[model samples]
Target: MLNIQNTKLFWASCLALLVTSLSFGIRAGIMNQLGIDFQLSTSQLGTITAAAFWGFPLAIVVGGFVVDMIGMKRLLVMAFIFHLAGIVLTIFAQGYWSLFLSTLLIGIANGTVEAACNPLVAALYPENKTTRLNHFHLWFPGGIVIGTLLVTLFVQLGLGWKVQVAMMIIPTLIYGYLFSKLDFPVTERVSSGYSSSDMYKAVLSPLFIFMFICMFGTAITELFTGQWIGLLLKNVTDNAILLLTLTTGIMVIGRGFAEPVVHRLAPQGVLLLSAIFAAAGLYMLSTFTGNSIFFAAIIFGIGVCYFWPTMIGFVAENVPKSGALGLNLMGGAGMFAVSIYTMFMGNFYDNLIVKHLPAGASLSVYLKAPENSASAQALANAKNLAGPEILQATLIIPIILIVAFGGLVIYLRSRKKSRSVAL
Candidate 1:
């Protein structure tokens, strides 16, 4: 189905995916570094990490609305600009607000990229949209692995975080050049003369609502881990950076094999399985108490591996020409939901940890002073009495979403069956 050797378009699709993947790594790794250097609390850190997702909802909404009108090339070019500007601002950012704004720009740019490219990939590979989309997403984890390795080395060698963020400019420019040269195909759905009113009507359809639910859960699954795993490790272990990379390593490996895996099970089956794995992993990680804690991350990575891109692929294959609007809404809604989830985690941590430090207590004292810190450390301390409670909340949210989305999938299948019966 790939036939990369025979088609530059195939290669271009891969390259575009690579560009976005590389872009995410630059932002995430550097954000982790910033959290440490700035002495930010988990809540403050969450805000920064979540900033990239803050603009996502709107970006998807607006990007989808304009994608067909503006064309893929223009939106992609705009995405490149937003990402580039975000990275540049991040390098120079001295305060939390600067970092937040910069990350927000990156979020917006990423939404634009998804809005443009998700549909483009489907249009280009109509018959194998799911597999190709899954394959295209391989670059995301691949880039994370590369970025993690490079950032680790750079940090160890005493290079500043600025250097790591500055490195993002390379892919942004290269991809911009390639996108400038590539020709994008128009999809059949958009090519038909469906009026603007009809296109808008599709956005309000039951199918679109079902897909949104999928996108939302999938977003929480992927971002909840990607954005928090590093912090989760630091809260539990000394080798946080290594642990972060290890989980992402598993994610890369999973995505590498996801094309064939998705092929065998198909998108819906893969999604159901992924949700189960993800729910179990989240519960386990949230309650982890031993050195075996690292295993939970691996499991979580495996569970979330096919989620984000597969959600995009599902939209592409099922909705096809929902056009740029469909792509933007999916990406935007996903990111926005994640940003909200991260913030929720942050607020809980802040109220429970940062706000109520006892008299004459330092952070270290509050963290380690057994009796005094016990309440504050409930979420952080794997052995704390309240840890399980917190973990249960995170696990339950996803479990519920999974059940809801699973029902939607079943309904769709039944509807199709009935249609066939009537025929």
Candidate 2:
């Protein structure tokens, strides 16, 4: 233990994680709400659902540069302003464009928070960087647990999703105020005398590239499953909301336990095993159609629990020279993965399977028309074709990527040991 007394720093980092996680939580909770409220077609739904992810890459880049140029304090403030503004915009969003734009703004804030806090936590506890990082990430899924339950309650109480979204502002405001009083450490690019060239070199290394591949798979696995779980569950189970809550709740619990688990297994071993389970889980989720489908989700969640944070934590442990640049690069690369996966998968899913209604059918007809209309027939056909089986099978992309990343990591480690022996 590094005699850690900076409770403020730790909690502030957790709050940042919580804020980012809740964005996904609220978005998942309200995704269906948006479709119903806006009478969106499946294509429109896919685009809007992926809009938040589209902002992530830019947010990561801009936030990192801003933190380097200005400071984490200023970046945090900017992120909070953007987050608050986006949340408000989303609550009152009238149509597709507004929802897309608002989510992009929120994505910026989410990415900024990650860019700032990840490096901050690593600096606060240099010796226990990975452990602290994993612990900090616990709040993310933890926040999702809270958000899921809260939104479920609100819906049951007849408050609607808008009110549920507005509740996030309370935490945003509180965290913003608390962050104001804390001392933000200078980013590595500033304190360590790393020039732009050095940072670029750090980013271009084989190690960095391998980690980036892991980041891509982790981001795809985390977001696609959580975001689309509701859709997947609905295809197999009657109570989609309850099943979603259970799956998310289990995910949170698994993340909570990951710190201790990673400590024992080591990051590499854990990641290797995680890939195996993740592949099997995705295969199960895809091939199985019964209530047993959720069992696969559980396994998938457990396997991926340590994947994302451990990717960042690996850099913190191994790449000290990269400094804040390392942490920012991790966040940037990870969210960039999110942006690409969301855009690619969502669009492909929509155009390939979701678009087009039956003859004489439109968005309005799907929303308010009788059950026997052509719109209903078209929607049913679309839903049936694009069912849980197909959606879960799509997860094979991440599972395959995970195996490749594992092989890459293995090759890198072997090469490093061989070089050391020659030296």
Best by TM-score, which number?
Answer: 2
For residue 251, give model 1's deviation from the true position in Å. Answer: 3.0
Q: Candidate 1 lDDT (Cα, whole model)?
A: 0.71
Q: Write the per-residue lDDT of candidate 1 for residues 1-423, one digit (tens) a residue.
A: 335422666565566566566556655666656755665666788888787787767676787777777777888888889988988898889888888898888878877777777777776777777776776777777777777677778878999888987877887888788778766666445775656776667767888878786777788777766655555556566665565577778877887677679888777778888888889888777778567778887887788888887877777667654655766688888888888888888768555544445444455434334443565464355323333444566777668767876886698789889999999
Stretches of candidate 1 above 4 Å error? 1-13, 355-391
Instruction: List TM-scores for all candidates, in order.
Output: 0.86, 0.89
Q: For model 2, how does the per-residue alpha-carbon lDDT over 204-258 read when each residue is reduced to its tens digit?
A: 7877777776777777777677777666455456655554566566666766677
After aligning candidate 2 to the native by TM-score, how far in Å is the CA of 264 from where it should be?
3.2
**Deviation (Å) of 236 in candidate 1:** 1.5
Pairs of colliding residues, candidate 1 = 64-325
